[model samples]
Target chain A: MPDTAFADPDAGLSPAELAARHGLGFAGTRPTLGGYARQLWAYRHFIVAYSNARVSASFSLTRLGRLWQVLTPLTNAAVYYLIFGVVLATRHSTPNFIAYLCTGLFIFVFTQTVAQAGVASITGNMGLIRALHFPRACLPIAIALIELQNIGASMLVLTGIVLLTGEPLTWEWLLIFPALALQMIFNTGLGMFLARLGSKMTDLKQVIPFVMRTWMYGSGVFYASSLFAEHLPRWAAVIVEANPMLVYIELIRHAMLENVKLSSTLPHLWLLAVVWALVVFVGGYVYFWRGEQEYGRG
Target chain B: MGVAEVAERPAEAGQRIPTVIVDDVHVVYRVQGPGTPGSGSPVAALSRMLTGKRTPGLREVHAIKGVSFTAYRGEAIGLIGSNGSGKSTILRAIAGLLPIEKGGLYTAGQPSLLGVNAALMNDLSGERNVELGCLAMGMSKADAKKNSPSIIEFSGINERGDFASLPMRTYSSGMAARLRFAIAAAKKHDVLLIDEALATGDARFRKRSEARVRELRAEAGTVFLVSHNNQSIIDTCERAIWLESGEIRGDGPTADVIKEYQQYMNRK
Candidate 1:
């Protein structure tokens, strides 16, 4: 046999160099941002398939199945309307109160569901994470898509409610599409951010419902955005008006209702909505990706 | 072949390319102690929450400490260790499922870990789960559809007549594990890590899986089988590494390593 000792001695090279020379990659090193994006893009079909399967399985045990997607939110709106619109009489100050409450409740519930699902996405799928290797972001993104699907189903009911409330369809109605798209982006970003946080701190899941309830009250889901300006201090009113959910709610209301009033002091709601979506989407995405190597680890 | 002849042969004779090079890798698990302090009554939980003092006692377990090994393409290596010897941790680290605490682990391609428990969902039907499992492994829908028949046949779950149409919860543990192996082994992998997947199956199924593993190795894929069954290791692997308490105790020809390991175990 040829002398094995003198054959290609890699004695001088470092382990990384040796790995590079031999076409091997260092394990546990985070993929580059572009590479990660490419991997995620390649798994787009998987994300869609997972989202569809989860949506179908979510309501399988119930007799109504997928119908609950629309009914659950509609029923929630009905209860809130009974308490706030009739009992509490917040509707006296608001125009087209049915449309207004439905829009706000649907929009707030969309974000609320997205946030809760995002928190559970990682913790719930520890089995898949530990078993197979794929993009961990797929879990949160798929959860977001499930919420998106639910909102898509709920939007039909919302449109019918707006029409039944004697609101004439104007050119402003076309703006609802962009408004919903922006909110979806915002919800996706928030979901990803919360997923990372929830994975690290399991206690966050326990606190999210309380946090979301306070957020809903602050978002003016049951009342008009103008109510916040009239009743609250300037700082609190500014905070309420700047809430992304309120911005989305107002945008949707402006789109669907011809006579819906918006706060004059809340400057450029459209621009603020776009900026909020971008900030949360990009910020939450990067934050989640930074912890990509840490998920499913003990 | 005799031990002398086995030692005389080059370990990398047919497959000169090293598919995996685990260089002095380390893995540590941080386990939370029971003194977490806030799990009492709701009043105490609220008080502790308000004080912002939620620090729990922490314990660090150095699971794998400085494990180094090189695996060549077409070589099936068995990792034999006692309980808590970090065998599964090493396999998981190579599969890129676990983060390494220190040192370098290099692999030529994706290392797919064969875990029967993780892929199949209980609530979904077996057919649906097969499709999802294939999709989860990055298979396109069309490919998953085309492979479904052979996957079903390979798993032999169809012998029960409409069992594939039933929910996976109705499957026995052996059936579930068999289906899991079938799904994992269906796809060609560059580095496949099997962690006791064959242990749950019967003798016939184990033989079939061993043959599939050999086929994978023949395809120039490096296979790492972690098992407590020494006979399976000796039968399937040409090389073996014995681990004891987070360290490599022996590494050589499978029979040689097995002999030493058996002796050490019997003496204990």
Candidate 2:
């Protein structure tokens, strides 16, 4: 009755209005960037609390409480080392291999979980999603934050492994913070991409595991990037060196492994990390935002 | 009771722009199966290429036809409709969860929608979700932390051992729903949407929550409750909107609208 004209009851909010509201999303309808930013900003607290609840909920039913946090990932590292290190003899130094594999696998596992789970995050939580009016991006961001906690626990275990392996401390480990931060940014985008894809094509869920396993082999989790650094072509070596996780792992390896330099591949590493992180994050976020109105329908 | 008498009321006290405005919201739902729509799949397309026409299985559903209403401050509204009459859909779109096809929905403030079952994360503890629900209701973390204990106490589920420690998955459907209502009611939002979240609770808790909701109304806020129980709406709210097939069939004072609705329902 109060001038109901703005409520078109046809085609919803106009494209320009959407773009203005949620600037980073698909900009045709209801284009209101500042509004979307404010909404996302207001919902940040919800994201944090949701993430915290998820992380803490893991221990609520278990007898050991939060101990399962360390135990779950630590045991996983041990199991993988048994198969890949002792049995397959993954061939870094004898003692170094365990620590190396633990760091690489532990870190990589979390990233993969984020990538895989992210695809279905919005769809998976459609119940709460349909009921609440929070930013759609909050779903993936919450998972990313939760993944951070799981990875943090594993990283702590990796630190212990490195120290026990007789690797000395150095400033090189400081790089891990930035490297890990960049990986998080990169995965944030990857998660967005996967979440949008998952909603549109449900079978992508089945395909993700297959893709992840193939990615793991070439990820240098078990093999040394240094081995290939010497003989590989510059572009190929640089591209491989730039795998965000590998660079991040190298930072971890550098901190843990004494006498390891920052690597001559650092330039190539930084360049590709920056570029891929941007493409995945910005591109994925935009793609996800475009599908905002459709998510609840599923 | 007539239009002139109703119009006699000042718009501010209020009746004009209703504190909560839902203007002709139209929601269209499309059914596209897991596979590609229109073309079916690659095989379907290839077969079509080999034969004549491509198969299509996409269907568009108009969940809500054009609907409009306004509820002024201090007015507690009830939406009555059969299953999927677009009752929940309208509420969600009004709360800004679902996008509207046509129409403007302007809330005086954030409207918290607590459906019958709470629909919360089953893996979290009751208290943990309370904290989350409060935060989701737009309360600051410090405020949510401060309010969690009272919310648990109000729901009358605080005595259980697993109340704070047990996973929500371990709780009964009734218990989880109660926790959601208690938590949502903890905050002082300008507008609240309750989609029959009270049926699971005992009578005493219901009475208590109803009183709190009245208090919410007195504080310059509006509440919309969707329910099939005509008696509850007649007993609690001042206004009722009858929705049939996603359109507003009737909207007026509760007793008056309920009278018309009863006669209409009886006719069918």
Model 2, A1-298: lDDT tens per residue?
2222222222255433432332322111342445655766888899898888777766666789878878988898888888988788775543477777777787788789998889789778878887766678888888888888888888888788888888877777887787678778888888988888898776688889988888777577877767657778888877666666776666666656765544445666666667777888888878887787777774
Q: Model 1 TM-score?
A: 0.92
| TM-score (0 to 1) of chain B for each candidate | 0.89, 0.85
Q: Pick the candidate with the highest TM-score.
A: 1
Winning model by lDDT: 1
DockQ of each: 0.47, 0.30
Candidate 2 residues B1-268, lDDT tens each?
Answer: 2211122124353323345555566888766564455466678768875896523444678988887655556668899877778888787777767767776566655677778745676777777778788877667778988998889888877665547667678877767777888888887767788898877777887788788888887777788898888887877787777788887767766777778777878898
Q: How much DockQ does model 1 earn?
A: 0.47
In terms of lDDT, the poorest run of 10 residues in model 2 chain A is A2-11
In candidate 2, position A262 carries an lDDT of: 43
Stretches of candidate 1 above 4 Å error? A1-14, A264-267, B1-15, B33-54
C-alpha displacement of A158 in model 1, angstroms? 1.6
Write the residue-wise lDDT of candidate 1 on B1-268 in tens digits.
1222123225463325667887788899876545546555577668767998664545688999888767776778899978999988899899898888998999987889996556556767788888888888888889989999899888888886989988787899999999999989999999999999999888888999999999998888999999889999989898888788888877768988788888888999
| lDDT minimum window of 10 residues, candidate 2 chain B | B1-10
lDDT of each: 0.83, 0.73
